[model samples]
Target: MKNQSLACAEFSESQIHALIHLLSDPDHHIAQTIHDQLVSIGHPALPLLGLAERNQENPILLDRLSSVIADIRFTDVEHAFQALTTSSTEEVNLEAGAFLIARTAYPDLEVQSYQRQIEDIANILKQRCEPGLAPRQAIQTINQHMFVELGFKGNIQDYYNPNNSFLHQVLDHRIGIPISLSVLYLLIAQRLNVPVVGVGMPGHFMVRLKAEPVFIDCFNQGVVLSEKDCAKFLDKYGVDFDSHYLDPVSNNQILARMIRNLVAIYQKRDESNLAEQFTRLLNIVEPRE
Candidate 1:
């Protein structure tokens, strides 16, 4: 493996500054070359790029710096994600996978801060979870805390917003699409020792208690549903219902699905570059057989 420090050390500070200054060149070819060079320099150039980005007044130059910074950040995310996928563990850490995926959109995301937020929420719910509480009653308590107190809701007004696919953004806004919301619920439930698992049903995502035949539609205010209700949802969406859809998914599958959501969104919006980025992540998570 090439040493990143050694590779970056080849470019003197002055040379890196010159390249950043040239990023706004009027000539497209010159600007493209500068961009490529900065990207190749990788993380070592980030401190300079970030400083330049903060002081930059020209919108074009600022955009170039931002792009380079995002590229550098994604390189790290890709390496970490690959390791997570290739590790020997049978069950990957779902929270870690989700946060890593979020880092793609928010390069500077505070992963530990968000983790602590989830932990705090779980702790509060744990106190409310009384001894000998029935599964359904416990779910009701969780639903109230999540939807009513915390104010998490389905982002129905702008369902296709890309932010809905990011874990940090979802936590910040308290609104997200099905899968992200279900992820939040699952994460908290896991901490509380609740017998809940993510249910990647067709066209919608939910969580089901392990001890009951009940499914909770996190996107819909945590409304409880039966297996038949899930089948109806599938039928309404023109998807053939299969029993396997209710099975718990691994962290790898969940991350792949999140990336798939972004890919489809970007494709629909004609943002080919963004779509390609997420598609690459999807392949990393669930590579072609």
Candidate 2:
């Protein structure tokens, strides 16, 4: 069995070697043909290319191989994300959905690392809560920890940067767009049993206390807002006020909105490949004809 495994490994390595050589071909059509063949080999091509990349002295061949490996990694993430959409659970796991989206840009991201970061914040909030504290007071403590102490603010300077859409990046940089920040706030609030729900307001995202008439705008340092305030903000933006907009969105709906944001950003930047990928993800989450 060992010998057979070794033989198979050698065969795969030999195939990779031939493909790498053809990658340097002068003809564009030949190079594309070689690229397609390697990608068709799928995940198996990744390790072989990694070994070749380490030993390769040619810069052009190395660059081409790197691009191919990236595409393969992205395709793998895309497949996994699509599979999650068809999961048996009624509502998609929000953290998992966000992490899957993050993997598109950060293929090597450690999901547990981000989860731990969120848990740590929740733990601190848990410790800070006074025994039998009012729900509103408890929420204020969370806001102070998240926005003031931790300094998580909106990335208003570069609001359109695709990085703002990634949860992991938001955690690292302490800044993100409104929707990403709102998602982070919602997740932490849920962990702390604060009864917060995401409010997918038009052109703005926020959270609302389940039994209270209060809304929290996470992008603005968790400032509490009244329903009338939300209505006024919407009116100022020329969006008709709809009470339904304040309703708690499902995990799938939040994910669909995130995907839509990414699609718009990519399309604006003329990144058709990425835009198409997110569009497909959006369809999976909210299928349309």
Candidate 3:
């Protein structure tokens, strides 16, 4: 599997058969070879070949680990479109958001309307902030201003489940309430410059503020936190203060967390029909692995 060029005619039935098998190899050179072959042939092997390579396990994640490279190489939206389902979870939503944000940059896609929505959300948050509010204070003010003052019931997770615990517990049922709020918090806080991080703690998805003057928990309605309290929380959850346990998330990641929360909640409710929304969502957001 040395780094060498590949061609389409060079790819025989044997090579095609080994597509999945080669992807599992520790050395990713085989996968790169496949990519070279596709690019050489300029064949319409996108979406399928791209997704297979992405989802299938491979060591030392190569540049091709992303579905984006395939997206750029092939630009086949039709095949990708056919795979879509009704489920649009938060990560899927974020992925969709990325796609939309990109597509809307053009005059052809006619997604300009969404820009207004984004602007509206941003505008409301920006115009309605109290001067000199800390990140925690800002989140609380935003929540209260939107929830109680503006009557935003938001999504509540009264029920809980155990399966579908992918990156953000997309299948867990009990933690969806705070999960959704955390998603909103991350999205809104970024504009406020709060520097929120994600805590992928067992059985729960939470957020921590890294901004100065105070550490805070957005999941608990922007509760101001201390390192001591965080340590206690970790002890209660049986997770030490390991780096992975209390990581912050990005805007898209936050959105993905919310969708995952809903997926778990609905799946546990025995709503197979409803669960599909999240299942399809996972494919779009995380794209398998």
Candidate 4:
């Protein structure tokens, strides 16, 4: 690991393989040194590490290879998230941000495939909808098509399953928590030219129209609610309701909330390392706000 800063091209193929095989060394210090060397080589070591993981019979060596690949991939994800959070544009694509978070868990996810799934759903619903439909009628159409026809519903039995928070998984399974469901609804609404926005309530997430005061609860069969009803629901939960909680949250704020949800889930499962990883991601997106 002496020439840690050297370009990956300087290291020959056999030299890198020698380092990878040395990962099975009995000495912990020696093995760690080899791991660090491979990591320092960065993305260039990925292909060899993947090959070693598949061909190697030793479980320990396989685990080490997997760790190295994850480290390198996570570094790339961090840089991508940083760039997304720091962009100058006011309108960030919510779907893009959600998929980026999903990539943390699924490094090889085909994003376009999932995008097409959502697009197909929108297209089917678009055929049913006519121009200049009423707000309530539009909400009813979406609810019927999404929940009743498509079989999307809340995962109340296993609410904390991490899949409930990931967009791709939610789309695949059609079951998710409030925030993820709201995100799916918002995205579909955007496609149909509906003026919907996310309402980041303290205990629950919902969606509503830009000019209307009614809230649509995507998790519960797209149930409609008035501002007074939302306030009373908050009171029932012993939470003091504030007007700002009903205000539309930006896409970045929604992504921050998603990260925070992951951190809480990992903490609950006693996965301290994963919790810390998501906490760092939260810092990158949420900032001090």
Per-candidate Cα RMSD to the true structure, in Å, reads 2.2, 3.8, 13.1, 2.8
Which tens-of-lDDT digit does each residue in 139-238 have in candidate 2?
8998899999999999889999999999999999999998899999988987878888888999999988988889999889989999999999999999
* Candidate 4 Cα RMSD (Å): 2.8
With a 3 Å backbone cut-off (N, CA, C), the pairs that clash in candidate 1 are: none
- All candidates in order of lDDT, best leading: 1, 4, 2, 3
lDDT of 1 at 63: 81
Where is model 3 poorest over a 10-residue stretch in terms of lDDT?
Answer: 165-174
TM-score of 2: 0.89
Which candidate should be chosen as best, given TM-score against the real structure?
4
- Alpha carbon deviation, residue 263, candidate 4 (Å): 1.0
- Steric overlap count per candidate: 0, 0, 14, 0
lDDT of each: 0.87, 0.86, 0.48, 0.87
- Model 3 regions lying over 4 Å from their true place: 1-140, 143-157, 161-176, 191-194, 210-215, 251-256
Least well predicted 10-residue stretch by lDDT in candidate 1 = 1-10
TM-score of every candidate: 0.90, 0.89, 0.45, 0.91
Candidate 4 TM-score to native: 0.91
Q: How does residue 246 of candidate 2 score in lDDT?
A: 92
Q: TM-score of model 3 relative to the true fold? A: 0.45
Local distance difference test, candidate 2: 0.86
Q: Is candidate 1 or candidate 3 better by lDDT?
A: 1
Model 3 Cα RMSD, Å? 13.1
**Cα-based lDDT at residue 10, candidate 3:** 65
